[model samples]
Target: MMPRLDSNTDPFRRPNTNHINSIYKQNLSKFQNFSEELTKRYDELTPTKKILVWILAVFNVIAVVLILIFHSYIIKSLVKLSDKWADLKFGHLLLFTLVFMVGFPPLLGFSPLSLLCGMVYGFPYGWPLLASAMFTGSFASFLVFRYLLHKQAVRLIQANEKFRAFSDILKEDQSLLILILIRLCPLPYSLSNGALAAIPELSAWTYALASLITSPKLLIHVYVGWKLKSLGDETKTFATKVVDFVSILITGAASALTTWLIYSRMQRKLEIYHSSRQQTNGDYDAMIFGNFDDNDLSSNNNVELDSNDFDADNFVIGDEDDDEEEVELDEVRAETDQADVTKSTSPTNSP
Candidate 1:
C-alpha cells in the first residue's frame, strides 16, 4: 500500500519555496539592470577618450613643426658659443668633456669633439688634458647617474630580457670584471657606464676599480688625437678617418669576444651553483628521512656504566623472589594477550 503523508509528521518541508524563487528573480533583474548601466557608462566614455586622443595627436604634430623651425637657429647659436669658448683652451676641453658625458649615449658619437680638443691643446698638452677631462667628466657622470638617473637606467635595462638576465648573472659574483670588460671593450661607453651604475651589485669601489682599469682606452684615444694634430691637413683627415674606422672595428670585435667569454663563464658558474644547490637539497632530504647511514645510534648504548652512582650489588635481587615476580608478571601478560586475541577472533552479534 502507498504510504499516506502528513505535513506535521514529515521532516522534509517546502514552505517559502515560492518566496525564494521570487527573491532570486528579483536579484537577477537587479544584476541585469546594473550591468546595463555599466555598459551605458562605458559607451559614454568612448567618444570622450577618442576626442582626447585626437587632441594629443594634434599637439604632438605642432610641437614637432616648431622644433624643426628652430633647429637651424639653435645650431647657429651653438656654433657661435663654441667659437667664443674656443679661446679658453682648457675650458673648451672641459666643455667637450661635459658634452660627451651628457650627450654621448643619446647622440652615439663623441670622437670628433675629442679630436677638436686635441687640435686646440696640441700634442703633449692635449693628450694629458683630454685624458684628465674625460676621466673627470666620466667619474662625475657616473656618480650623478648612480644617484639620480639610476631608476630610469634600470627601467631601460629591464625593457630588454637579455639585459635583465645579464643583471641577474651580475648579482651572483658582483665582481668588477664585467664592468671593466664593458668599459675596455667598445660597448657604447656612456650607455655601459649608466647601466652599470644602475646595478646594485656593482659597489662604488668596484666601479672605481673598473674605471681605473679601463682608463687606458681613453688615454689611447687621446694619444691618437694628439698624434693626428701633428700631421698635414690632408694626412690628418685621412688619419682621422682611418683611426675612427679601425677603432670602431677593433672595439666591435673585442666587445663581441668579451661578451661571448662573459656569457660562457656565467653559464659555467651557474651550472656549478645549481649542482651544489641540488647536492645540498639531497643531503637535507636524506637527513629529514632518517637515511643518513653514517649515524650510529647503537654505538651510544655502549656508554660506560657509572660505578660511583650505581652499584650492581645494591640493585641485585635474590633468585627466589625474582623468579616468583617473573612468573606472576608473565601470567598477567598471558591473560591480557588471550583477551585481545579472543576479541579479534570473535564474530559480531547484533544487539
Candidate 2:
C-alpha cells in the first residue's frame, strides 16, 4: 500500500516463516521418535544369544591359557597314549587302533605319526592298522569338511593362489600321485586333507591310494614303539635317535625333490604360455598390416574416382540404339508373317 504494490508481488503475501518452521520441527520430532524406536530394538538382544556369546568368549580365553601353560603336558599325554595303545595285544590292538586312529591326527602331524605307528606296531600290524586308520580319518574329515565347513575351507584354499593351482591338479587323474607325493614329502597332511576335502574333483579312491602309499612311515613308528618296549633303555634311546635322524633325512630329501619337480613343471608351463602369447602377437601384427594394406588400396581407389567426377549413366547411354522402335516393329511384322505361313502349312493349327 505504501508504493501501490501488486498483491502477488508483495513479499508478505507468501506463507509465514513460522509455518515452515513448525513443519520442520514436526518432522524432526518424528525422526527422533523413529531413532528412539530403533535404539530400543537394538537394546533388546535375546538372553540365549547373550549367554552364548559370553560363554564362547570365556572358553576361548581359557583355551588360550591352557595351550600356553600346559604345552608340555599335552605333548606327554599324546606320547603316553601312543605307548599305551601300542602295548595292547590283538583284541585290545583292535580297540587301540580305533581310538588311536581317531585321536592321533590332531596330535601328530600325518607323516611323523604314520612313521610312529610303523615303529610301534611293526611292519605287518603297523602297516595295515595305520593305513586303515589314515584312510578312515581322511574319509571322515573329507565328509565333515565337504558337508560342514566346505565354504570356509574353500575360501582358505583359494586365498593362496598356489594352493588353488595345486587343488586343480589334485582334481585330475594324477590326483593320487600328487597326494602320495605330498604325503611322502614334508607337506602338512592334516591341512592338506582338510583342503583336499573342499575340492570337488578329489575322489575316495584317490584319497585311499595316497593314504596307503604314504602310511608306511606311520606304521614304522608304531613298530618302533612296540619293539622299544622289549629293548634295554640305552638300545631304545639309540634306536629312537637313529629313527628320528633317518626320518628327518628322508623327509628333507623328499621335500627337496618335490619342490624341484613343482618348479620344473611351473617353468615348462610358463614357457608354453610365453610361446602362445608370442604367436598370438605375431598373428595380431599380420592382421593389422593386412588391414592397413587393404585400407590404403581402398583409399587410393576412392581418390581416383572422386577426381574423375564422372556420372555412371553417361557412358552406357551413349551406346543406346535410336532405331530400337523401328527394329522392334519390323521384327513383329516378320513374326506375324511366319505364324500365318505355319498355320496354313500345319494340319492341327488350321482348324
Q: After superposition, how far is residue 131 of candidate 1 from its true place, in Å?
A: 3.0
Q: For all the candidates, what are their Cα RMSDs to the real structure?
A: 26.9, 24.3
Per-residue lDDT for 209-292 in model 1, tens only?
Answer: 777676555544544444443332333466675665576567557656866676556556656766876898998887545353
Tell me each candidate's TM-score: 0.42, 0.42
Candidate 2 lDDT over residue span 39-63, tens digit each? 6755686888677877998999999
Stretches of candidate 1 off by over 4 Å are 1-100, 103-107, 122-125, 226-351
lDDT of 1 at 176: 74
Residue 130's C-alpha lDDT in candidate 1? 55
